[model samples]
Target: MHRFKILFVCMGNICRSPLAEGIFKHMTDNAARAGEFEIDSAGTGGWHQGNPPDPRSVAVAAAHGVDISTQRARRIAVGDFDRFDLILALDRDILRNLRKIVPAGETDKLQLFSRYARGIDEDIPDPYYGGREDFDRVYTMLLTGCTSLLDTAGKLRTS
Candidate 1:
Protein backbone atom coordinates (compact mmCIF):
# COMPACT_ATOMS: atom_id res chain seq x y z
CA MET A 1 0.00 0.00 0.00
CA HIS A 2 3.02 2.27 -0.19
CA ARG A 3 2.62 5.18 -2.59
CA PHE A 4 5.47 5.91 -4.96
CA LYS A 5 6.75 9.35 -3.96
CA ILE A 6 8.28 11.70 -6.54
CA LEU A 7 9.81 15.14 -6.07
CA PHE A 8 10.59 17.17 -9.18
CA VAL A 9 13.41 19.73 -8.88
CA CYS A 10 14.56 22.77 -10.84
CA MET A 11 16.42 25.98 -10.16
CA GLY A 12 13.30 27.72 -8.84
CA ASN A 13 10.06 26.04 -7.92
CA ILE A 14 8.03 28.74 -9.67
CA CYS A 15 8.86 27.43 -13.10
CA ARG A 16 9.79 23.97 -14.36
CA SER A 17 9.32 21.78 -11.32
CA PRO A 18 5.80 22.92 -10.57
CA LEU A 19 4.73 22.30 -14.16
CA ALA A 20 6.13 18.79 -13.88
CA GLU A 21 4.37 18.17 -10.58
CA GLY A 22 1.12 19.50 -11.98
CA ILE A 23 1.26 17.54 -15.21
CA PHE A 24 2.07 14.31 -13.48
CA LYS A 25 -0.56 14.85 -10.83
CA HIS A 26 -3.21 15.72 -13.37
CA MET A 27 -2.39 12.68 -15.46
CA THR A 28 -2.46 10.31 -12.53
CA ASP A 29 -5.69 11.75 -11.20
CA ASN A 30 -7.33 11.42 -14.59
CA ALA A 31 -6.17 7.84 -14.94
CA ALA A 32 -7.66 6.96 -11.54
CA ARG A 33 -4.16 6.20 -10.31
CA ALA A 34 -3.72 9.15 -7.97
CA GLY A 35 -3.74 6.98 -4.90
CA GLU A 36 -0.78 5.01 -6.20
CA PHE A 37 1.59 7.95 -6.11
CA GLU A 38 2.55 11.02 -4.08
CA ILE A 39 3.83 13.86 -6.23
CA ASP A 40 5.41 17.25 -5.38
CA SER A 41 8.04 19.73 -6.54
CA ALA A 42 10.80 21.96 -5.15
CA GLY A 43 13.70 24.13 -6.24
CA THR A 44 17.40 23.87 -5.70
CA GLY A 45 17.21 27.34 -4.14
CA GLY A 46 14.70 28.97 -1.79
CA TRP A 47 14.31 32.33 -3.51
CA HIS A 48 10.66 31.89 -4.43
CA GLN A 49 9.60 30.06 -1.28
CA GLY A 50 5.89 30.31 -0.46
CA ASN A 51 5.04 31.92 -3.80
CA PRO A 52 2.84 30.10 -6.27
CA PRO A 53 4.07 28.93 -9.65
CA ASP A 54 4.86 31.80 -12.00
CA PRO A 55 1.81 33.37 -13.61
CA ARG A 56 3.05 32.28 -17.01
CA SER A 57 3.53 28.73 -15.82
CA VAL A 58 0.06 28.71 -14.31
CA ALA A 59 -1.42 30.09 -17.50
CA VAL A 60 0.40 27.61 -19.68
CA ALA A 61 -0.75 24.68 -17.59
CA ALA A 62 -4.26 26.06 -17.51
CA ALA A 63 -4.27 26.31 -21.30
CA HIS A 64 -3.50 22.62 -21.39
CA GLY A 65 -6.31 21.77 -18.92
CA VAL A 66 -4.05 21.45 -15.92
CA ASP A 67 -4.18 23.97 -13.10
CA ILE A 68 -0.93 24.58 -11.31
CA SER A 69 -2.22 27.73 -9.68
CA THR A 70 -2.28 26.37 -6.15
CA GLN A 71 1.19 24.89 -6.07
CA ARG A 72 3.49 26.90 -3.80
CA ALA A 73 7.22 27.21 -4.34
CA ARG A 74 9.63 25.57 -1.91
CA ARG A 75 13.27 24.52 -1.65
CA ILE A 76 14.65 20.99 -1.80
CA ALA A 77 14.69 20.00 1.85
CA VAL A 78 17.06 17.60 3.61
CA GLY A 79 14.38 15.12 4.52
CA ASP A 80 13.12 14.99 0.92
CA PHE A 81 15.98 12.69 0.03
CA ASP A 82 14.59 10.11 2.38
CA ARG A 83 10.91 10.81 1.78
CA PHE A 84 10.88 10.53 -1.98
CA ASP A 85 11.52 7.38 -3.96
CA LEU A 86 12.60 9.56 -6.86
CA ILE A 87 14.15 13.05 -7.03
CA LEU A 88 14.03 14.15 -10.67
CA ALA A 89 15.94 17.20 -11.87
CA LEU A 90 14.76 19.15 -14.90
CA ASP A 91 18.22 20.03 -16.09
CA ARG A 92 21.79 18.88 -15.71
CA ASP A 93 22.73 21.86 -13.59
CA ILE A 94 19.94 21.18 -11.16
CA LEU A 95 20.83 17.50 -11.17
CA ARG A 96 24.39 18.40 -10.28
CA ASN A 97 23.23 20.71 -7.52
CA LEU A 98 20.95 17.99 -6.16
CA ARG A 99 23.87 15.58 -6.08
CA LYS A 100 25.72 17.85 -3.70
CA ILE A 101 22.92 17.89 -1.16
CA VAL A 102 21.59 14.33 -1.41
CA PRO A 103 22.49 12.32 1.69
CA ALA A 104 24.70 9.26 1.56
CA GLY A 105 23.20 5.93 0.46
CA GLU A 106 20.33 7.86 -1.09
CA THR A 107 22.15 8.87 -4.24
CA ASP A 108 20.37 6.14 -6.13
CA LYS A 109 17.17 8.13 -5.92
CA LEU A 110 18.49 11.04 -7.97
CA GLN A 111 17.96 11.11 -11.75
CA LEU A 112 17.62 13.46 -14.72
CA PHE A 113 14.01 13.95 -15.70
CA SER A 114 14.84 13.78 -19.38
CA ARG A 115 16.12 10.28 -18.96
CA TYR A 116 12.54 9.19 -19.18
CA ALA A 117 12.19 11.08 -22.41
CA ARG A 118 13.70 9.34 -25.36
CA GLY A 119 14.95 11.11 -28.54
CA ILE A 120 14.16 14.56 -27.20
CA ASP A 121 16.05 17.40 -25.56
CA GLU A 122 17.93 16.23 -22.52
CA ASP A 123 16.94 19.23 -20.42
CA ILE A 124 13.77 21.12 -19.69
CA PRO A 125 15.09 24.66 -20.05
CA ASP A 126 13.96 27.36 -17.65
CA PRO A 127 11.40 29.70 -19.16
CA TYR A 128 11.27 32.20 -16.30
CA TYR A 129 12.88 35.08 -18.21
CA GLY A 130 11.21 34.41 -21.54
CA GLY A 131 7.79 35.17 -22.95
CA ARG A 132 4.65 33.04 -23.11
CA GLU A 133 5.95 30.87 -25.92
CA ASP A 134 8.83 29.76 -23.74
CA PHE A 135 6.47 28.51 -21.14
CA ASP A 136 4.42 26.84 -23.80
CA ARG A 137 7.43 25.03 -25.17
CA VAL A 138 8.37 23.79 -21.74
CA TYR A 139 4.80 22.63 -21.29
CA THR A 140 4.97 20.53 -24.42
CA MET A 141 8.19 19.01 -23.26
CA LEU A 142 6.76 18.29 -19.82
CA LEU A 143 3.72 16.63 -21.31
CA THR A 144 5.98 14.34 -23.28
CA GLY A 145 8.30 13.71 -20.37
CA CYS A 146 5.63 13.28 -17.75
CA THR A 147 3.86 10.72 -19.90
CA SER A 148 7.02 8.68 -20.01
CA LEU A 149 7.67 9.27 -16.33
CA LEU A 150 4.35 7.77 -15.39
CA ASP A 151 5.02 4.80 -17.62
CA THR A 152 8.33 4.19 -15.91
CA ALA A 153 6.81 4.58 -12.48
CA GLY A 154 4.18 2.01 -13.33
CA LYS A 155 6.86 -0.49 -14.22
CA LEU A 156 8.67 0.21 -10.99
CA ARG A 157 5.49 -0.42 -9.11
CA THR A 158 5.09 -3.87 -10.60
CA SER A 159 8.73 -4.81 -10.19
Candidate 2:
Protein backbone atom coordinates (compact mmCIF):
# COMPACT_ATOMS: atom_id res chain seq x y z
CA MET A 1 0.00 0.00 0.00
CA HIS A 2 2.99 2.27 0.01
CA ARG A 3 3.08 4.95 -2.64
CA PHE A 4 6.27 5.39 -4.61
CA LYS A 5 7.22 9.03 -4.22
CA ILE A 6 9.00 11.03 -6.95
CA LEU A 7 10.13 14.62 -7.25
CA PHE A 8 10.99 16.22 -10.60
CA VAL A 9 13.42 19.15 -10.48
CA CYS A 10 14.62 21.93 -12.77
CA MET A 11 16.33 25.31 -12.55
CA GLY A 12 12.92 26.94 -12.14
CA ASN A 13 9.74 25.10 -11.32
CA ILE A 14 7.74 27.07 -13.86
CA CYS A 15 8.77 25.19 -16.95
CA ARG A 16 10.26 21.71 -17.22
CA SER A 17 9.64 20.28 -13.76
CA PRO A 18 5.99 21.24 -13.67
CA LEU A 19 5.44 19.72 -17.06
CA ALA A 20 7.10 16.53 -15.92
CA GLU A 21 4.97 16.40 -12.77
CA GLY A 22 1.77 16.82 -14.75
CA ILE A 23 2.63 14.34 -17.47
CA PHE A 24 3.67 11.66 -15.03
CA LYS A 25 0.54 12.18 -12.98
CA HIS A 26 -1.61 12.03 -16.10
CA MET A 27 0.09 8.83 -17.18
CA THR A 28 -0.35 7.17 -13.80
CA ASP A 29 -3.97 8.19 -13.54
CA ASN A 30 -4.66 6.94 -17.02
CA ALA A 31 -3.18 3.58 -16.15
CA ALA A 32 -5.29 3.48 -12.95
CA ARG A 33 -2.05 3.38 -10.96
CA ALA A 34 -2.37 6.82 -9.52
CA GLY A 35 -2.92 5.48 -6.03
CA GLU A 36 0.46 3.86 -6.16
CA PHE A 37 2.44 7.05 -6.62
CA GLU A 38 3.11 10.36 -4.93
CA ILE A 39 4.37 12.91 -7.47
CA ASP A 40 5.55 16.54 -7.25
CA SER A 41 8.01 19.03 -8.76
CA ALA A 42 10.47 21.65 -7.49
CA GLY A 43 13.18 24.07 -8.59
CA THR A 44 16.80 24.49 -7.60
CA GLY A 45 16.21 28.19 -7.00
CA GLY A 46 13.35 29.88 -5.18
CA TRP A 47 12.98 32.90 -7.45
CA HIS A 48 9.56 31.80 -8.59
CA GLN A 49 8.41 30.14 -5.41
CA GLY A 50 4.62 30.14 -4.87
CA ASN A 51 4.07 31.11 -8.52
CA PRO A 52 2.30 28.82 -10.92
CA PRO A 53 4.05 27.10 -13.75
CA ASP A 54 4.93 29.14 -16.84
CA PRO A 55 2.06 29.62 -19.25
CA ARG A 56 3.86 27.89 -22.06
CA SER A 57 4.31 24.78 -19.96
CA VAL A 58 0.64 24.80 -19.06
CA ALA A 59 -0.43 25.25 -22.68
CA VAL A 60 1.78 22.46 -23.94
CA ALA A 61 0.57 20.09 -21.24
CA ALA A 62 -3.01 21.08 -21.96
CA ALA A 63 -2.45 20.37 -25.65
CA HIS A 64 -1.45 16.89 -24.63
CA GLY A 65 -4.51 16.44 -22.36
CA VAL A 66 -2.70 17.18 -19.11
CA ASP A 67 -3.28 20.22 -16.92
CA ILE A 68 -0.38 21.61 -14.92
CA SER A 69 -1.92 24.97 -14.08
CA THR A 70 -2.53 24.17 -10.44
CA GLN A 71 1.06 23.35 -9.57
CA ARG A 72 3.04 25.98 -7.65
CA ALA A 73 6.76 26.63 -7.86
CA ARG A 74 8.95 25.78 -4.88
CA ARG A 75 12.65 25.36 -4.32
CA ILE A 76 14.05 21.95 -3.58
CA ALA A 77 14.38 21.43 0.16
CA VAL A 78 16.58 19.30 2.39
CA GLY A 79 13.42 17.55 3.61
CA ASP A 80 12.70 16.41 0.06
CA PHE A 81 15.68 14.10 0.15
CA ASP A 82 13.91 12.08 2.78
CA ARG A 83 10.44 12.50 1.31
CA PHE A 84 10.88 11.11 -2.17
CA ASP A 85 12.12 7.70 -3.14
CA LEU A 86 13.43 9.23 -6.37
CA ILE A 87 14.60 12.75 -7.13
CA LEU A 88 14.99 13.23 -10.87
CA ALA A 89 16.84 16.16 -12.38
CA LEU A 90 16.03 17.55 -15.80
CA ASP A 91 19.70 18.04 -16.67
CA ARG A 92 23.23 17.25 -15.60
CA ASP A 93 23.74 20.61 -13.90
CA ILE A 94 20.66 20.11 -11.80
CA LEU A 95 21.85 16.59 -11.04
CA ARG A 96 25.10 18.01 -9.76
CA ASN A 97 23.27 20.58 -7.66
CA LEU A 98 21.16 17.81 -6.16
CA ARG A 99 24.22 15.73 -5.40
CA LYS A 100 25.73 18.60 -3.47
CA ILE A 101 22.75 19.02 -1.18
CA VAL A 102 21.49 15.47 -0.86
CA PRO A 103 22.14 13.98 2.58
CA ALA A 104 25.02 11.49 2.60
CA GLY A 105 22.98 8.32 2.98
CA GLU A 106 20.26 9.62 0.70
CA THR A 107 22.46 10.12 -2.33
CA ASP A 108 20.95 7.09 -3.98
CA LYS A 109 17.67 8.98 -4.38
CA LEU A 110 19.15 11.39 -6.94
CA GLN A 111 19.21 10.62 -10.67
CA LEU A 112 19.21 12.07 -14.18
CA PHE A 113 15.70 11.70 -15.61
CA SER A 114 16.88 10.82 -19.11
CA ARG A 115 18.21 7.54 -17.80
CA TYR A 116 14.64 6.27 -17.84
CA ALA A 117 14.13 7.40 -21.39
CA ARG A 118 14.55 4.66 -23.98
CA GLY A 119 16.91 6.35 -26.42
CA ILE A 120 17.66 9.79 -25.05
CA ASP A 121 20.78 10.25 -22.94
CA GLU A 122 21.13 14.03 -23.00
CA ASP A 123 19.95 16.58 -20.49
CA ILE A 124 16.45 17.91 -20.97
CA PRO A 125 16.95 21.48 -22.06
CA ASP A 126 15.24 24.37 -20.32
CA PRO A 127 12.57 25.77 -22.61
CA TYR A 128 11.58 28.84 -20.59
CA TYR A 129 13.11 31.36 -22.98
CA GLY A 130 12.09 29.63 -26.18
CA GLY A 131 8.91 29.38 -28.24
CA ARG A 132 6.18 26.77 -28.60
CA GLU A 133 8.43 24.50 -30.63
CA ASP A 134 10.81 24.32 -27.71
CA PHE A 135 8.05 23.39 -25.33
CA ASP A 136 6.80 20.79 -27.77
CA ARG A 137 10.22 19.18 -27.95
CA VAL A 138 10.48 19.04 -24.16
CA TYR A 139 6.99 17.57 -23.92
CA THR A 140 7.92 14.77 -26.29
CA MET A 141 11.00 13.92 -24.31
CA LEU A 142 9.11 13.93 -21.02
CA LEU A 143 6.32 11.77 -22.34
CA THR A 144 8.82 9.15 -23.39
CA GLY A 145 10.77 9.34 -20.16
CA CYS A 146 7.77 9.29 -17.85
CA THR A 147 6.41 6.24 -19.59
CA SER A 148 9.68 4.47 -19.04
CA LEU A 149 9.77 5.53 -15.44
CA LEU A 150 6.30 4.14 -14.80
CA ASP A 151 7.18 0.90 -16.52
CA THR A 152 10.14 0.51 -14.21
CA ALA A 153 8.30 1.25 -10.99
CA GLY A 154 7.63 -2.37 -10.23
CA LYS A 155 11.36 -2.82 -9.82
CA LEU A 156 11.52 0.23 -7.58
CA ARG A 157 8.74 -1.24 -5.50
CA THR A 158 10.51 -4.54 -5.13
CA SER A 159 13.80 -2.98 -4.32
Candidate 3:
Protein backbone atom coordinates (compact mmCIF):
# COMPACT_ATOMS: atom_id res chain seq x y z
CA MET A 1 0.00 0.00 0.00
CA HIS A 2 1.63 3.17 -1.17
CA ARG A 3 0.50 5.98 1.08
CA PHE A 4 -0.01 9.40 -0.43
CA LYS A 5 2.19 11.97 1.30
CA ILE A 6 0.79 15.44 1.88
CA LEU A 7 2.28 18.60 3.34
CA PHE A 8 0.23 21.70 4.16
CA VAL A 9 1.85 25.12 3.90
CA CYS A 10 1.13 28.56 5.37
CA MET A 11 3.09 31.70 6.26
CA GLY A 12 3.91 30.18 9.63
CA ASN A 13 3.47 26.58 10.64
CA ILE A 14 1.98 27.80 13.90
CA CYS A 15 -1.46 28.48 12.48
CA ARG A 16 -3.40 27.50 9.37
CA SER A 17 -1.20 24.73 8.01
CA PRO A 18 -0.96 23.00 11.37
CA LEU A 19 -4.72 23.18 11.70
CA ALA A 20 -5.15 21.70 8.27
CA GLU A 21 -2.68 18.94 9.09
CA GLY A 22 -4.52 18.07 12.27
CA ILE A 23 -7.96 18.28 10.74
CA PHE A 24 -7.00 16.21 7.76
CA LYS A 25 -5.29 13.67 10.00
CA HIS A 26 -8.38 13.43 12.17
CA MET A 27 -10.61 12.95 9.17
CA THR A 28 -8.45 10.22 7.74
CA ASP A 29 -8.03 8.50 11.06
CA ASN A 30 -11.77 8.45 11.64
CA ALA A 31 -12.27 6.96 8.21
CA ALA A 32 -9.69 4.24 8.95
CA ARG A 33 -7.49 5.57 6.17
CA ALA A 34 -4.80 7.00 8.33
CA GLY A 35 -2.32 4.34 7.26
CA GLU A 36 -2.89 5.27 3.66
CA PHE A 37 -1.73 8.83 4.09
CA GLU A 38 1.28 10.73 5.36
CA ILE A 39 0.31 14.19 6.58
CA ASP A 40 2.47 17.07 7.83
CA SER A 41 2.65 20.86 7.91
CA ALA A 42 5.33 23.47 7.18
CA GLY A 43 5.71 27.22 6.84
CA THR A 44 7.09 29.28 4.02
CA GLY A 45 9.20 31.18 6.53
CA GLY A 46 11.51 29.83 9.22
CA TRP A 47 10.52 32.16 12.04
CA HIS A 48 8.25 29.69 13.77
CA GLN A 49 10.38 26.62 13.39
CA GLY A 50 10.50 24.34 16.44
CA ASN A 51 7.47 25.94 18.03
CA PRO A 52 3.98 24.57 18.52
CA PRO A 53 0.91 25.80 16.70
CA ASP A 54 -0.37 29.15 17.93
CA PRO A 55 -2.37 28.96 21.13
CA ARG A 56 -5.52 30.00 19.30
CA SER A 57 -5.08 27.32 16.68
CA VAL A 58 -4.57 24.68 19.33
CA ALA A 59 -7.63 25.84 21.21
CA VAL A 60 -9.78 25.94 18.09
CA ALA A 61 -8.85 22.43 17.02
CA ALA A 62 -9.37 21.13 20.54
CA ALA A 63 -12.86 22.69 20.63
CA HIS A 64 -13.64 20.68 17.51
CA GLY A 65 -12.29 17.37 18.89
CA VAL A 66 -8.89 17.39 17.24
CA ASP A 67 -5.59 17.86 19.03
CA ILE A 68 -2.89 19.75 17.19
CA SER A 69 -0.93 20.82 20.22
CA THR A 70 1.65 18.09 19.76
CA GLN A 71 2.62 19.21 16.33
CA ARG A 72 5.70 21.42 16.01
CA ALA A 73 6.27 24.15 13.47
CA ARG A 74 8.86 23.65 10.72
CA ARG A 75 10.04 25.49 7.66
CA ILE A 76 9.54 24.09 4.18
CA ALA A 77 12.65 22.40 2.91
CA VAL A 78 13.99 21.59 -0.54
CA GLY A 79 13.62 17.88 0.18
CA ASP A 80 9.91 18.36 0.86
CA PHE A 81 9.35 18.90 -2.84
CA ASP A 82 10.40 15.31 -3.42
CA ARG A 83 8.95 13.86 -0.23
CA PHE A 84 5.32 14.94 -0.49
CA ASP A 85 3.03 13.75 -3.20
CA LEU A 86 0.95 16.87 -2.73
CA ILE A 87 1.83 20.25 -1.24
CA LEU A 88 -1.24 22.30 -0.36
CA ALA A 89 -0.72 25.98 0.32
CA LEU A 90 -3.12 27.88 2.57
CA ASP A 91 -2.99 31.07 0.50
CA ARG A 92 -1.83 32.48 -2.81
CA ASP A 93 1.27 34.08 -1.37
CA ILE A 94 2.39 30.84 0.23
CA LEU A 95 1.61 28.95 -2.92
CA ARG A 96 3.70 31.41 -4.90
CA ASN A 97 6.55 31.01 -2.47
CA LEU A 98 6.38 27.24 -2.75
CA ARG A 99 6.34 27.49 -6.51
CA LYS A 100 9.43 29.61 -6.47
CA ILE A 101 11.42 27.01 -4.54
CA VAL A 102 9.94 23.84 -6.01
CA PRO A 103 12.40 21.92 -8.09
CA ALA A 104 11.80 21.84 -11.81
CA GLY A 105 9.37 19.08 -12.88
CA GLU A 106 7.63 19.15 -9.49
CA THR A 107 5.24 22.02 -10.15
CA ASP A 108 2.31 19.69 -10.64
CA LYS A 109 2.48 18.62 -7.02
CA LEU A 110 1.76 22.10 -5.69
CA GLN A 111 -1.84 23.32 -5.27
CA LEU A 112 -4.01 25.65 -3.24
CA PHE A 113 -5.57 23.98 -0.23
CA SER A 114 -8.97 25.30 -1.28
CA ARG A 115 -8.80 23.76 -4.72
CA TYR A 116 -11.22 21.04 -3.78
CA ALA A 117 -13.41 23.10 -1.47
CA ARG A 118 -17.00 23.45 -2.60
CA GLY A 119 -17.64 27.19 -2.73
CA ILE A 120 -14.25 28.65 -1.92
CA ASP A 121 -11.86 29.34 -4.77
CA GLU A 122 -9.35 31.49 -2.95
CA ASP A 123 -6.80 31.17 -0.18
CA ILE A 124 -7.76 30.25 3.35
CA PRO A 125 -7.55 33.48 5.35
CA ASP A 126 -4.76 33.96 7.88
CA PRO A 127 -6.38 34.19 11.29
CA TYR A 128 -3.27 34.89 13.33
CA TYR A 129 -4.00 38.53 14.06
CA GLY A 130 -7.72 38.01 14.54
CA GLY A 131 -9.75 36.86 17.53
CA ARG A 132 -11.43 33.58 18.46
CA GLU A 133 -14.10 34.12 15.82
CA ASP A 134 -11.41 34.15 13.17
CA PHE A 135 -10.00 30.85 14.40
CA ASP A 136 -13.46 29.32 14.42
CA ARG A 137 -14.05 30.52 10.87
CA VAL A 138 -10.74 29.05 9.77
CA TYR A 139 -11.60 25.77 11.41
CA THR A 140 -14.86 25.58 9.49
CA MET A 141 -13.13 26.38 6.23
CA LEU A 142 -10.49 23.69 6.86
CA LEU A 143 -13.11 21.06 7.63
CA THR A 144 -14.76 21.61 4.30
CA GLY A 145 -11.50 21.80 2.41
CA CYS A 146 -10.01 18.72 4.05
CA THR A 147 -13.08 16.64 3.32
CA SER A 148 -12.99 17.55 -0.33
CA LEU A 149 -9.26 17.00 -0.43
CA LEU A 150 -9.70 13.42 0.77
CA ASP A 151 -12.24 12.81 -1.92
CA THR A 152 -9.84 14.15 -4.51
CA ALA A 153 -7.06 11.94 -3.22
CA GLY A 154 -9.29 8.89 -3.39
CA LYS A 155 -10.17 9.63 -6.97
CA LEU A 156 -6.56 10.07 -7.89
CA ARG A 157 -5.65 6.75 -6.30
CA THR A 158 -8.27 4.90 -8.28
CA SER A 159 -7.30 6.58 -11.52
Residue 4, model 3: Cα distance from true site in angstroms: 0.5
Tell me the tens digit of each residue's lDDT in model 3 across 10-118.
9989989999999999999999999889999999999988999999999999998999999999999999999988999999899889889999999999988886445
lDDT of 1 by residue, 1-159 (tens): 789999999998999999999999999999999999999999989999999999999999999899999899999899999999999999989999999988999999998998854445499999999999999999999899889888889778632
The per-candidate count of clashes, in order, stands at: 0, 0, 0
True-structure RMSD, every candidate: 1.4, 1.3, 1.4
What local distance difference test score does each model get? Answer: 0.91, 0.92, 0.91
Q: In candidate 1, which residue ranges exceed 4 Å CA deviation? A: 117-121
List runs of model 2 lying over 4 Å from the truth: none
How many pairs of residues in model 1 come into backbone collision? 0
Worst 10 residues of 1 by lDDT: 112-121
Worst 10 residues of 3 by lDDT: 150-159
TM-scores of the candidates in the order shown: 0.96, 0.96, 0.96
Cα-lDDT of candidate 2:
0.92
Residue 46 in model 3: lDDT: 91
Model 2, poorest ten-residue lDDT window? Answer: 150-159
Residues 1-159, model 2: lDDT tens digits: 789999999998999999999999999999998988999999999999999999999999999999999999999999999999999999999999999899889998888999755556689999988999999999999998999998887468632
* Residue pair clashes in candidate 1: none
